[model samples]
Every structure is written in C-alpha cells, then in structure tokens.
Target: MSQLLRRGVLVACLALSSLLLPLLPVSTVAAQSGPAVTTDKDVYDFGEPITVSWSDAPGNPKDWVGLYPTFAGPPGGSSGATLWDYLDQGDGQTVTPEGTLTWSQQRPGQRDTWPLAPGEYTIYLLVDDGYEVVASTTIRVTGDTDGPEPPPEDEWPANPSDPALSRKLRAMTFNIWVGGTQVKFGSIVRAVRKARAQVVGVQEPGDNLERLANRLGWKHTFTSDDGYTNLISAYPLSAPKRSDEYAWLRFPGGGRVAVSSVHLTPYPYGPYDLRDGASTDYVLFNEGTHLEEMKSRLEALSALAEAEVPVVLMGDFNVPSHLDWTSATAAARQADGEDFVRPFPWPLSMSLAEAGFRDSFRTAHPDPVQQPGYTWTPGYPPPIGDQPANLTDDEVFDRIDLIYVHGPVRTMSSRVVGESYRNAHIRVRPWGSDHRAVVSNLRVRPLYRR
Candidate 1:
C-alpha cells in the first residue's frame, strides 16, 4: 500500500509540471503578426453611422489614427488620391490597440452635406506613427439620395432662344475679368444664359468656380490648377485630361466634344524682355509667340482637335491672328496706322489653322471686313495687366480672344456679347472685363455613340 501511494504522488507531480510549460516567459507569443484594421460593415445607408476599429497593431496604446476619403490603390501616386474630406480634427488622435472611431453620416465643412449624393467613394483608415502613414485599408460607400436640385428658372434668368441649333451646339468664351469681381456674379451668370451656350469657358475663374457652378446650376464644372481658366456645362463632364499648357474636358453622351481651355503666356515676352520686339526665328521663336509656349500648346490643341471626337479649342490667346495680320487685312486696319511690325503670320494662329480648326468667329462672319469681330475691348475702361508698349488704342482693341474648332461643325451665328460702350451690338450688363465675350452657335454633325 505504501509503494502504490508513492507512485501515485509522483504521477500527479509530473502532470502539474507539464501544465506550467506554456506559462514560461520565453514561450509566450503575440496574438497578431503586424498591424491590421477593419470596419464593422462594408456598406451603409446615407447618413448612417459606421464604426472603424484596428487590431494586431503592435504599438504603444497612444498611437495616432486618421480617416480620409481616397480614390483607390495603395496610399501613393496616381492610383491613390486623397480628397479634402478628413474625418479627424487635424492629422488624427492617439488611441490604443483595437482602438475604434465612428464615422457619422455628416462630414465636416460646407461641401459636406448629409445624405451624400449616390456616388461611389472610398474611406481610408490611415495609421500615422507621427511621421508617416504606417498601415491603411479602404471602405466604399454609395450615396443614397437623388442628387442636388437645380434652382428654379424663375430664380435665375431664362435662357435665350436657339431655333437655329438643330444639329450643332453653341460655345461661349468669356474672360470674366479679375475672376468676375468687377461685375455682379449674377450678371455674368445671366449673360451666359442669355447667350444660350451649351458649353461655356471662362478665364480667371480662380477660387470662385464652385460659387459660379452653384449659381449657374451647371451639372459639371472644372477649374485649372492656377485658376487661369474653367469649363462649365449643363451636361455631365468627364474627368479633365490635362497637361501644364492645356486642360481638356470630355463631354460624354451621344458624341463626345473635347473642350480645351488655355490662357497662353501673356505677352510671351515679359520674362524674356523680348515681348517688346520681333524675334530672329519667327516660326521657331518669337517674342510675341509667348515664349513659343502658345505655339506649342496650339499645336497640341490641334492634335487633340483632330481626334476621332470633335474638339473645341477656345480662350484668350493674347496673340494676334494670322487672318487679321495679313497684308490685305493690314490694309483694312491701316486706319490704325502702319502698325509696329509688317504682316507676318503669327505662329499660334498658323499652327491651329494647319491643324484643321477654323476660327468660329471668322467662319460665321465670313467677311472680316464687315465684322472685324474685335474681342479685345468692349469700351470698358477697366485697367488691363497686359497693356504693352506696341499696342496702341487701335492695336490694343484688335481681336485676340478666339474660339477654334475642328470636324463637322458649322457656325450658324456668331456674335460678341458684352457691354455696348464701344460694341456694335446693344450693351449687355455684366460686361466689366476689358475684353468682350464671344458667343458662337454651331451645328455639330451628329456622331451617334452606343
């Protein structure tokens, strides 16, 4: 009996030692490999709240976390983009492992109205260890509301009649001087509607684009990097495809119209000190050529205009047109006196014409003699930044701003729209810019798309 009792005690002691193996210090293991994050739900209704949490985050309890809206791909380069919407107060707040945050239906700021529009957007969970984005993940949400409503017609002025537009479209180019601060924004908006242009482009829209888009009730609006130009339309606008010299908007629907807006190097000579005189290689290099950037861009615009889809190239060219500077036209404008330089085909205009685009204004006018169609001034005495030495009252007043288009497009009617101070047409209010606006009505040859 004694021997059997000792054997039983030894067996029990061995079992107890085996149970202590896992509790040893070196034997312990972490619950996770690296930082991991997740959301409670993949989708949610508009204004619906969501919970975001992180796990396996090997860090101090007080680590920073942030939430932002991103497009797609890893958190770098083109594949990834971060919108202005940031959920946190600043970069983020410190929190513990398995920390959580809530995304309410409402985002901060005036642009963030609750019940977001029904569009797919990505939510990014960014863990920043003070200096950089450590780990991240994304959640997508489709808005659940009928989009925004347009202001009543009575609220805004009515659009002008266009009985002539059966196959073509009208495009307007307006340089809203100083970002339209010179005149009432309503006046500009009303002027646009009166022209009844389907597509409108403006120079110097600056930061006021959203405000302009809001008032005009345009479905689409695009602003250039420097706010030098913008394109607004009633129809949907495809994402802008751009280069430093130009930006193009693709109009999607039955047929696409690639609209390119450019504010070429003004004077083309300010930086080079040659803007005041003629150049050696007139074609390859000209002081008035705007450092040849204008010619280069116009060439690019021409190539784009030649694409399968029709293209509308418009803007304040700042350089003279080849048609106007011709010996014949020069004789006509001789009233302005023999100008500084004899007629030489400006490279900017020559390149565009060669690329297959005709001046919409000239096309509609046919006779430059009857209607010089000067776009430089409308008699508004507002000071201009580009007042140069060679440009006298006559040369300063010549037509420079232009609308160029290629393909099966015909100008039904084209006219200058602006204040009547010095214009042939009756004065229209809201024309405060030193330059007048060009309104061109064109018939686009129907190109049906599936």
Candidate 2:
C-alpha cells in the first residue's frame, strides 16, 4: 500500500481507537505514537495572539485542530470550536504531517476576532474533522483586558517657583540587601546623602540602621525585632509601633508625619505564580496571607488615613502595585517582548490605595509604560547569597520598593536610585544593595494644632 493509503486507513481507525482508549490500560496509549498538539507558551497575557503547533497528524486534508475553553467538554461538532483550521487549506485534499496555525484578530475562514478570555483553554488535534481527540495540551490566557483606566497625568509642577510651595520633605525607601553588608557600608551612607533624603526607610537593616544613622550624624532610628524593617531619619521618631514598624516622624521644621517601614513576606509571589499558570484566585490568596498578617498595621494606617496628619509608608513591599500592572501596561510590555505581566489587583498595594495612600513614584510619573521605576534589583539574578542562581532566567524586574504618601502631601518628583545611569535618576557608584532605592520629593502641609 502507498504511504497515503496507509495513512488513510489509520485515519479511518482513529475514531474507533479513541472509543476504546478509556477501556485500555494507560500504558497501551503511552506505547503508541499519535498526533500531538502544543502551544508556544503555557501562559499568555490576555489579547496576546496564540500559536498552536501540531505533529504526527494523519495528513488527511480534513484533519483539523480546534481551540476550546478547558471546561467546554470534548470537541463535538455541535459544541462549536472557539477557533479552528484545516491541516490543509479547505480546497486541498493533502496535508503535511506537521504544521502550525496562529489565531489573532482572525484565523483562516473566520472573519470575526474570537479573543480568548482569561482562563485555561485546550487545543485538540482531532481525526478527519471528527471530534476524536488524537492529542491535546492546555494553555492559559490571563489578564484584565477590559476597561483599561487612562494612564495618569503627571501632576507635579515643572518647577516650583515659590520656596514655600516647593516640596520640603525628601524621603527614600531602600532595601539594603542584608543590611548593606553586600558591599562597602559607606556606599549605603553615600547613597542616602547624595539623594539628600531627610528620612529613609530601610529594609533588612540588621544592626546597620544605627550604623548608618551614626555615620550620617542622624539622631533617630527604629529597627524591628526580626531585623526585616527599619527606619533612620535625620530628625526624631516617636510612638514607635511594632509589626511593620510604624513611627511618628518629627521634622525639625515643626512638622510631624506618620511613617511606616515594612518588608512583607516574599514567597509564593503573585507574578511568578501567575506566569507559571496558577489561577488568579491562587495568586490573590497568596498575597492575602501577607495582608492577614499585617491586619493591625493596616488598621492603624487606615486610622491615620482618616486623621489630618501627613503619612508616608515606605519599604520593600515584595509585591507589585496594581497601578503598574494594568491591562494597558501588560500589552505595552508584551509589545517590547516582556510577556508575563498582567492586570492583577495585588491585595496589599490595592488595600493601601483603598486606605487613601498613593504610590509616590506613580503619583509623580503616572504613565507606567513610560516610567516603570523598577526598584527590585539593578542586577538580574543578582548572584547574591542564598538566592537561586537560575533567577536570571525566571525573575521579572519590578518596582517593589516604594514610598507611599497620603493626606496633606503632594509628590513633587520621584526617581529611582540604582547602580547605573540608565535605570536610576541618581546613580550611586558601586551600589551596595541588590534592590534599588526610591526617593520622592514631597510638598508637606504643616500640622495644624488645635
């Protein structure tokens, strides 16, 4: 028999074979070669195009692949495939054994765009246009693809003409990786001095907060028991609270601002999990665990939010802001070849915003596409202690370190401080820490005492 004839016979038997597959032992199927289908990526941002590749097809012109939502059940002719195409053009009777099909705004023979919603989907390689699956695989499409909020407009003035109207409070948030012991401690001191930050929130400050304060002749410093979060200010700090270290900043100019420094748990991070095809609920649950732990701190901040005083919360949040990870920005990044980010409402950052705090960097530079302001690491993979060496390939650089403000404070300007000129507004030579620094200039309204 000719190869085509044998393939035709095999194609005819495929439907019968599929009916018996459930009754046969699993090993029987494992031993046989069959038509196979796969996607280029297991996960994709919503609205991003999808590509389905198949091999070992029966080569019948009628053999086709159908895209279906994972829960849509077995491919039935009446069920209707979300998108499909014949192995060969509809007119041809011969098909190659292997080929690829892409679905974007439209596919062959389809005029309307059928964009897959955010969820799991299945690709089926069926026999002779019949609903007998020869091989199949799953892929995830995720993102908030609807009603993208307009990018925020820059609200700060081009240049403050009045000294009184100019921003007076300069705050910096830095995760000095392992207390700046990663490099010369002096490098950390110089970074703060050069930024000219009046107050600084320091994360992972193990005994280094005081050392830094001493070097700068700063009188006040607060450190947590776990050595995870700390604060060092040029003025004095009062009413130091625990569980994320909330303190009262007493500026010499007679202004008091509420400050908190926090370093939330980093494991089971949402971006990594989401990229690995985890469900949105699972990602939100992971971040919710952190928020549950910081409930007291959040409540206190909420009360502060209701009060008349200016409040500043800063540190390594270990999570991305919902403002930065919008549907619009996800599409923007995918256009530039970074495809993992999606519109995820990270609970911690969203909760803070709900409590009236604003991301200072984002407040100054509202267009996420234009100013990503990534502060998580100047060096990808970092090559640092205890971090997995494979991080270079898996990690997404993000702006986790932040200085958030609320009440009578307006962000004049915010910029990143890092190891290089390209990523940082203020470059510090031989940057001491893995995470970059965030500095924001704020115009503060004086406290009104009754």
Candidate 3:
C-alpha cells in the first residue's frame, strides 16, 4: 500500500475511536440515590405551624421541592389535585430548606382551613432535578387540633337539693328531618310534647315554623337561612338570631341558657358520583360549608355564653364523633401544609371540645357503640336501602343527631329512645322519626351557690 493511503486509513481509524469513546458511559458519573426528604414530624395539630426537611437530591439540582397534596390514599392510586403551588418558587411565603414551613390548625386564619371539617390529608414532595422527579417520604396531616381530651362529663345540678329548679329546666335536641315527606307535623308535636322538654333545639324543620309551633302548641323562637329551625318553651323566648352555624334561642331561666340548633352539611370524600360507596371525600366537601358556618356561629355563641349567662347548647350536629377509616386517605392529605380547602368532621368536633362544651350523649353513655346510631334510617335512595325491612337487627346508620349541654346543667342519664330498633330479646314501637330522639335528664343549679 502507498504511504499516503496508509496515513489516510490511520486518520479515519483515529476519528472512529474518538467517536466510540464519547458514546461509552463515563465512569466518573455516579448513579444518584439518597435518603428521602424527611419531615421534622409526621402528625401536627390543626392551626399549629410545622416544618419539613430533606437531604438534597444527589443530582444537578434544577429546582427546589414542589408540593402536591392528595386527600390521603394508597400510593399510586387515584388522588385529588395538588393543593398548593411549588413551595420554594418564591411565592412570597416560600419555605427554605433550613427555614421551617408553618401550618395552622383547621380554624379561622389558616389558608387551607377555610372549608374546615375534620379529616386527614397527605403531603407529597416532588424534587425537581431537571431530568426526573425525586419524591420524598409522604407526610401525614391530621385536623385533630384538640388532642385526646374527651368532652366534659355531663354535670348534674350541683345542688340536687333544688328539686324545683331541676324539674322546671329541661333541655333536648331533636333532628326533625324536614326534608323527609314522611315527617308529619303531628309526629314532631307528639315527640316534643311527650318528652316534655322545656328548651328544645330542633334541626331541619324546613320553613314550617308557624304551623309546627301552632300544631305542637309551643312558641317558635329561632330560624336560619338554611332549613335549620329552633324553638324554646317554658319562658318567653327572644327572637332567633344567626350565629356560627346555628339559630341561637335564648330562654330566660332566671340566669339564661342559650340553645343552638344546627344542621351541618355533609363532608366530601370523593367525586360527586361515588358518594354511594367509598366517597367520604365528596361528603366532606359537601358538608364543609355548613361546618365552617357552624364553626363561626358556635364561636360567636361561645363568646355570648361567656359574657351573658350559662349555656345549655343542644342540637343535631350532623356528624358522627369517631374516626372514620374509609376516609383515612383523604384525612392524611389534609396534614400537608398545602393551600387546599376541604371539609372534615373530626376537626370541627375537636374545635367544639376545645370550646368547653360537653357532648351530653357521650357523657351520658361513656362506652357508646362506635358504629352508626340514632340518625340514619333506610329509605333515602340507592345504597342506604329503599324500603324498611326488619326494624330489628337492621343496621343502625349515621349517628348524626346529638344533644350537647354546657354551663351549670348536670346531666344525669341520657339515652336514645330507639338506639337499637331490633333487640332480639325485646320488642318496641318503631322510632317516631327516621332519627331517634336523644333525651337527657339534666339537673340545673344556680351558679356559685353549689
């Protein structure tokens, strides 16, 4: 071969070697991995602030961590939308890696707490590394700001000595289910008259105030923009005024006792359609507005009760006082300090407990059954049962109706008239209303004397 041809071939070979060297993976480039972003804490009280942290992703860091909140769920499942925007994107309130991110309890002032109900929420961290996302450990947020303190026990009149006072002051909470066509006016009249309750706080009475009061032979006092209505007996009651989430009824029992009747909207657990099955998300959202309004009203009522007189708050809270497992996914998502607004029940119940009022039903029966009781009865539509089957053994559904007492009233004994529709051993009349009446025997005593 000629020398020139040989040189040309050598040059071509050298060029090919350089190209192959560039194609080969470089040894200095290490595969990136590390401990996931770590939160300083897992659970936090609603309204309180919290901070989260993480070891920087081992890569060419492109952007700070962005947050997308899910309403709590199993990993890789159908989750809700992102609550807040990217956390560190200079959005005025961005949290630095060293600086802590704070979140308030599910109450007034907090951004995400607007539609405060009670439930869980999950916080997901997405680290922007230019090439791919590096997610951190999931943070769980709970709306239970009040902690584990149980409601105050029903206090019977400090001075049972005052028998006359005890007998004269009677309190009760009734959910009239105004939406139901079967809720006859006569039945409500019969229920109130039979109970002989002096100050009654009723819920869902629709717009039939005059007719209901006339039929029952009682004077009407309170009403709300929503269908919630209330009436007080025994003393000349003042006109009803709207408060936090109720129609406040003030009765002059020498000192005064304020009775609030409320109808909180249901919580939303899922999309509008899946409400029949596992859709607590939808229920929380639906009911959040009512809960928020009720919270505001209750706060006002609390202030009034503190200033003027003792309070014997009673009404249909329309929320079960227990942890719900089906909505746990949604509940965890609420924990992340995101700008998402959703509804939950536990948070509201926690707020009420913190406000110094006692749940009369819980106090009356310490170890009440955890399942649904007293409120829901079949016949609403699909899923809840269309026709009434055996009244006995039928699942007692939805413990939404409640009676709560505050101030100086001593709760002696409280029970649901038809707590168990089906007692295998005994027989009783069917519950008058879809919601069984919650009756309590209270002992009222003058403050300071006892």
Top candidate when judged by lDDT against the true structure: 2
- Full ranking by lDDT: 2, 1, 3
Clash pairs (backbone) in predicted model 2: none
Q: TM-score of the candidate numbered 3?
A: 0.49
| Candidate 3: tens digits of C-alpha lDDT, residues 1-450 | 999999999999999999899889877867876535556676555434545555544333233443334343422322232233244434434334333344434322213433333344444444442313455555544553343333332322121111223623566676666632353456566666666666667666666655666666766556544445465555555543444344333335444455566655432322211322334443444344545657666776677546533456666664555422123323443354321312334445555665656666667555433422344543222122234543423232445567665555567766554423451111123334556666667765433310
Worst 10 residues of 3 by lDDT: 155-164
RMSD in Å for model 2: 16.7
User: Can you list the residue pairs that collide in candidate 1?
Assistant: 168-443, 168-444, 268-290, 420-427
For this target, which candidate reaches the highest TM-score against the unseen true structure? 2
lDDT of prediction 2: 0.73
Model 2 TM-score (2 dp): 0.60
Q: Candidate 3: deviation at residue 433, Å? A: 3.1
Number of the candidate with higher TM-score, 2 or 3 = 2
**Every candidate's lDDT:** 0.57, 0.73, 0.48
Per-residue lDDT of model 1, residues 171-279, tens digit only = 8888777667775667677777777877777887756666766788876877656555578877666544455444444445565566767666452221121122323
- Candidates 1 and 3 compared: the better one by lDDT is 1
Query: Cα lDDT for residue 18, model 3?
Result: 91
Per-residue lDDT value at 271 in model 2 = 68
The regions of model 3 sitting more than 4 angstroms off are 1-168, 179-183, 224-229, 240-253, 267-291, 323-345, 370-373, 378-396, 419-432, 445-450
TM-score of each candidate structure, all chains considered together: 0.54, 0.60, 0.49
